[model samples]
Target: MKYSIIISFLLLTVCLTAFGQEKQSRKSKNPNSAAAEKGLIKVSVMYPFAEGKTFNMEYYETKHMPMVAGFLGSNLVKYTIEKGLASGIPNQPLPYMAVGTFYVKSLDEYQAAIAPNRDAIRADFANYTNVAPVILVSEVVR
Candidate 1:
């Protein structure tokens, strides 16, 4: 009876120790360290346009990215609009594209800026020649 009691006690201790260690690890990973340097959030919006489009490389490089950058607040850590030829599938040719990136201080700020005027935001790209675009949102979790 005494041996059985000791075994049960040991099992309880092992379980408690495992739980404690897991909790500590999670807290360390996502610490609310006000003094520690905060991380930036990066959102990449990918655009896919129709074929046979007339896209002025100069306008997108000089004008489009800059226009989006203006709407972002001062907290923007980085902003970029890039263009490249899409890598196509087998026996397929991909079209030219423009990609917009909004890198900010946090996810909440991103939601606040785009949620109210989503349609307007979509309309902003109406001028692109024979093209449709896709937007992808992601958090910079590191």
Candidate 2:
């Protein structure tokens, strides 16, 4: 009888342990469960300008960044990187580049914002550079 009780207790403990583990696994699968899972999805756009196009660089830094930030403000986290230093290679020119970031509650918000203002955005950079900028989207997983 004592051996049977011990065996039954062991089985109950095992079942309880397994149940807890399953619950934990399910929670982890939830995207909003962990803070790390709720990072910013950044849509990056890079523009490569032609030579003697310093005006393009100024437009981004002085005009575009400010206008965009006015809408985003402190609600989003952001950064920008520009590469203009010479490499001494005559053929290869250093192009102007900038990245604008906006943090939203979900991917839907990101999509919605871009859908309407897409044309206005492209127009905003118009008359600045002949070459179209490379736009790449990314998420901050960490």
Per model, how many backbone clashes are there? 0, 0
Candidate lDDT (C-alpha), each: 0.65, 0.61
lDDT by residue for model 2 (17-131), tens: 9989998898878856556435766666665556544336677777876665554545445556464554233334565444444554455666665567677667877645555
* RMSD (Cα, Å) of model 2: 18.5
Model 1: per-residue lDDT, tens digit, 1-142?
A: 8987787678667867987998788778877632232466777766665656655657655766666666676757778777766443222455446677877887787677767757765676655544665666675555
Give lDDT: candidate 2, residue 38. 57
Clashing pairs in 1: none
Task: List where candidate 1 sits over 4 angstroms from the true fold.
Answer: 1-39, 86-92
Candidate 2 regions exceeding 4 Å error are 1-38, 49-55, 71-75, 86-105
> What are the root-mean-square deviations of the candidates from the true structure over C-alphas?
15.5, 18.5
Error of 1 at 23 (Å): 35
